[model samples]
Target: MKRFLIFLYFISSALTALSSEKGIIDLADYHYNRKEYYYSITESMRYQYLYPRGELYSQSMLITGKSYYKGGDSGRALSVFSECYNRFTDSEAGERALFYSGLIRIDSESYNYAAKNFREYNYVYNNGIFLEESIINLSLVYALAENYDEAGKKIAGYREIFPEGKYIKQAEELSVLIKEAESRPEKSLLGAGLLSAVVPGSGYFYTENYMLGIFSFGTNAALIYGIYDGYKKKKQFQMIFFSVIEFSFYNYSLAGSIKSAHEYNENKDFKKELVLKFKSEF
Candidate 1:
């Protein structure tokens, strides 16, 4: 009777421990669903502490990393995700971790690193759940970096691999945009700088900033008149002051024109639109 009671007690204790572990994970998941990222992280970490080798260990790590990410602690999130990926490389959680790491890199504007992560995920998990997402995002990363050729190739590959993929429409749209962006004429920074040097606001005009060009030209013209008047009156202090002001304005116009030219060449409007679309879609 004593031995039987002891055996029963051990079974009950095991069941209770298992139940506690499950309860912690469930609570963490509930918090995560509610977007209570801090509490989710707390519960997930508690699970990890109480059940280091628990069957739900991978899930707990994933939740902890995701919570950190949703809470805007991207650095910590990346670290946790990388750790989870390393620990459970063949698991679903590891695949998601790798994919999310790439997304975090994209948010940071680290396009090269994002591309690497996405590529790695694609290569490592050919049939992974995030395969389609990784492929599209990889192409987008290249597009963002202005690597049109590579971007096009990736999009084509995505189409070939997933003929009826959910992202086909997006891929096609991005492809058209890429072609248009490539065909657009890029402004010359050197040309803009030279124009401004020769004609106070001509650079701004070349960069299509007519209002700024007009303001720059008017200001310089007025300053030139001031200097001329000062010289004619033989006023040394007035000439020096006008000369300083004109010099400063001329430099400002020149720099502004160059910056405008660079921005025009970069096609910032297209990039801004693309980024917004990418964020909304993905």
Candidate 2:
């Protein structure tokens, strides 16, 4: 009875191993055919563990990466594709790995990094799958980073390389906007003071700086009121003295008002320049 039990146990263990192997292969085929890529990836990975040196090893990795990509896991997809590219450089699957890697980076908003990877792939494979996309994304990154000069250079490069690209018209329009902004005059707060110096209240008015103008006018009014009030009190000597002082200071306020305008204009120039620079790059 003990010998019979041992034989039955051996048979059961052998069948279990065979069934597991069959299950892995069947699940892989079923999931792949049904376009359930996420499941296909799991089954394929299991198959790899069971048969590390199987003929399907490289193909399985490619499928797993593709599944991750389609399942909206771009970061993981990129990692897997990078591994495939490094581990199986001679395989046909490896040829496309870098191309997909660039796409994943671009999708993930690592625009500058994507551009570098794409450029490398293009250099090696001349006719890389996503060359135009790489160029467009590189241009966008420089623009977003406020590097207008470099961004402009990149746009020029794109025009030369892909004049008929799908987004050529949009790129051209953006270039024109940058040029227009670059041509505008710059403003500064100090310039407002200078404007006020040249013409009382002029600087504030020029910069649409009405509050400062009102404040300047109010100070003059207060001095004038003080002079008149002193005179109305019937203090003859005091009234004359206050009147002269008020008159002189009123003139001084006029001069200061003009200086304030100049400062306002200077400020305007600076702000205008800042806005122009930002728009040009972005």
Candidate 3:
């Protein structure tokens, strides 16, 4: 009975894999808890391979995604997380997949895609653990991406959905900062140059450099007064020399003011982006 023997061998292999399932899952979890992500990844892969139809199939896939993420393999982590939920829509692991997928997209600076993922999570898993966090972060990502209009909508959604959400205070503060950020261009080349030309230090003030603005005002005022004094003294040599100095100093101040404004805006935007990025990491 060659066919019967072959069937018996298949049955034995299935029984052996079934018995090993508990050990496989346990070892994976043990390694994961110890932060041995690479080792955890190996065990998870083995379990998935041997137990394709196991009860823990979705959990195994989730473990694999988490391990890849912990091991600093984000692209791989995203891939596995997507596969987990795509394969098991009804499992709790699918809820986790939604959150992690959005998180990884944020880390990768794919803000729009991250927003989409978070939205899906919010709609599908309304009672999920990370829902509040997802809503708050979704608004931040849009702001960070410079899509302020969409960010504003997200804030409205946050308030409507969570009038006194956990992150309410945080969201309010961020909104204030973002509103301030939106009030003016970081550096307006034409604006800076025009302001500098009209008022020696006003451009610097507009750029929020008070000290430099004061210095520019004081320096230009002194030089201008010196030229005037020399002219009134009827000293030809002194007048010419002081006039030239004043002219050059005033000209340089105008250019410097514009440059400073540009730099100030650039630095401010950079810092804002950094703050947004750091929030995503946590």
Candidate 4:
């Protein structure tokens, strides 16, 4: 009985030492597999700090970023993914990092940037496990960036690349949506400006410049009130005062809001034009 107890005590001590040495890797992996991303990230970070050159460092970085992304910290995830891409270029973890970085970029409204990363991932891991997903995103990135021409070309390319893609239905629907967007006539800011000239504040409404219109209306009201008070006081100087204010601030705001409405339209049109240009090139 004494010998058995001694043997068990030594075994427990050995296990404790082993766990102390590999707690980061083992605990992180265990947490990650169980979908406990927050805990996984914590454990993985500890492992990374203790053993920067550990074999699991690449995975640790990858999972750390994944945890941040899942926890709604896309900016931090992007930063960590970039680090993984730079530090573990030859590892399988690096491939996943690059791929996921593109996805996060798209979500963060950096479509152009995501498109570049997606292209790089596609080239580096040609026909790899993520090939289908990468190709689908290639089309989607262009579309989200408002690059209809690029989106269309990429869609066609995707069809050729993945004739039987898992997301064929989704890709087809996206292709149709892009075509419809291309058909719509781009709105004209110059037209909006002309419309405003005919009807003061019309351009403001067209351009959704509500605050500016309110300011214009308010200024006009103040000018009228000044003129009325001057007439009541029988003061010639007050009439001139009201006239100056009416011609200056009130008129200026009205004209400016109309002009701004036109400019806003032009800027939106320019964005659409850029989208078409990107499509043709891509």
Candidate 5:
């Protein structure tokens, strides 16, 4: 009986090992397709560890990195991508890992790092599935880094290279947007304030707050006129009362003019920056 039980235990152990080895990769793929990213990572890593020279070894590493990225662990995702690409150079999986890592870097706003990876990708592969995407991302990274001239050049060069490419319009639009951001009016907060001090309400006009400028000028003119008329009539008490109101209005106009100048410039610059923000891919 003891010998029979020992024989049965050996058979069961062999069957379990065979099944685990064969099904490991398939299990990882199943989890990845279903968006069970954590499960996918576990199984993919298991395959990589147990079968380092297996047919799907590179694929397992790619799967593991992709799972980490899609599962919202960017740090781990980058680590895995780096390891896999380094381990399996000059292969589809290596190129794919590099491309995905670039995307992850771009998402994190690491424009310079993303640019390096994309440039390396271009250098490594003459042409492949990610060629167009890498070029497009390079243009975007340049723009995000505020290298407007470089960004424009990239866009123009890409258009020449791929006139009928799928993402040509996006690159062109980015170039146009960069130009728009560069042409912001050079009006200054200090200059606007000083102008309004010299010529009441002219500051708002300079800042393009036409309505506020008009209202400021009209209100100040009325108040000053009232105080002057009170004084000319020799109504001392009335003049003093109106003078107090005029002083308050006068102080507010000066301070408000400076504040309005600041607000207008701040809002103008904010909108200009939004052009870049909207164009940048998340």
Candidate 6:
């Protein structure tokens, strides 16, 4: 009878412990669902403290990382995710942690690191739940880093690997965007500088800065006419002053044209478009 009673006591204790463990994670999840990220993190941390070896340990850690991420604490979130991935590399939670790490890196504009994380995830998890997403983001990271050729290759590989994938449409769209970006016209810096040197503001026109071009041309023409008039009228002071001003303006115009050419090539529009597409699709 005593042995039977002791066995019942132990079973009761085990059940209670199990319930407590499950309860804590459920509370964390509840807070997370309600967007109470602070409370979610608190509860998740509590779970980790109370049950270091619990079956739900990975889940609690993941929730903690996600809460940090949602709360705009990317550095902490990344640290947590990296730890989770390192500790539980074979678990579902680990896979998700690695995926989120990649996403955070992307947001931070650390494209190389983001690409590495996504590539590692793909390599480690052949059948990962986030496989399609990883592939797409890998391509996006490449594109963001301005490696459009590699980006195109990644998208092509994604299409080949997952023809009916969930992100197939996004892949197709991104592929189109990459092609367009590649084909977009680029202003030549040498051409712009040479044009400006030959004709005051022609370089600005070459880079499509019509207003600046007009303004520059007018200013230079006025200065040149002033110098000529001064010279013809024997006004030495006026001629020398106009000549100095024109020289200064001419150099300024040349420099400005070269800078504009660089800006045109940088082309923020394509990057902005790509970013919007990534955000919308993801």
Best by lDDT: 6
Give the residue spans of candidate 1 off by over 4 A: 1-19, 232-234, 279-282
> What would you estimate as the lDDT of candidate 2?
0.65
Clashing pairs in 6: none
Instruction: Quote model 6's TM-score.
Output: 0.73
Model 3 stretches astray by more than 4 angstroms:
1-19, 188-282
Which residue pairs show backbone clashes in model 4? Answer: 149-279, 150-279
| Residue 144, candidate 1: alpha-carbon lDDT | 87
CA lDDT, candidate 3, residue 71:
85
Residue lDDT tens for model 2, 92-187: 667577766765664565757766775676576665555565555555545544456876887798799888987587668657755654564544
What are the TM-scores, per candidate, against the unseen true structure?
0.84, 0.45, 0.63, 0.66, 0.63, 0.73
RMSD of 4: 6.7
lDDT of 3 by residue, 1-282 (tens): 999999999999877754598778888988999999988888888888888899888888888888888888999999998988788766788888878898888777787898889888888888877777887778877776777787778878888888989878877877776687678556687787788788787788888888988988888888778878888988788878888887887888789888987787655465456356435442
lDDT value, residue 146 of candidate 6: 83
lDDT of each: 0.89, 0.65, 0.80, 0.74, 0.79, 0.91
lDDT for each residue of candidate 4 in 1-282, tens digit (9 for 90 to 100):
999999999999876754563656777768877878889888888878877788778888887888888778999989999999988777788888999898887667688888999899888888666777777777877776667788888778878877887767777877877786677554455655565455545556666677876666666777878898898898889989887877786556556865675566345554454344322110
Q: Over 4 Å off in model 2, which ranges?
A: 1-37, 50-59, 90-92, 165-282
For model 4, the superposed segments whose C-alpha errors exceed 4 Å read 1-41, 70-75, 204-282
- lDDT by residue for model 5 (1-282), tens: 999999999999976764475678788888999999999999987887888788788888888888888899999989988987898878898898888888888778788998899899999875967888788778777776767788788788789889998877777777777787568555677887787777677887887889988988887788778878888898888778878887786666677777877776455454446335433332
Candidate RMSDs in order: 5.7, 13.2, 9.5, 6.7, 8.1, 7.3
Q: Please give the lDDT score at residue 136 for candidate 6.
A: 91
Candidate 5 matches the true fold with a TM-score of 0.63
Candidate 5: residue 72 Cα off by (Å): 1.7
Best-to-worst ranking by TM-score: 1, 6, 4, 3, 5, 2
Ten contiguous residues with the weakest lDDT in model 3: 273-282
Weakest 10 consecutive residues, lDDT, candidate 4?
273-282
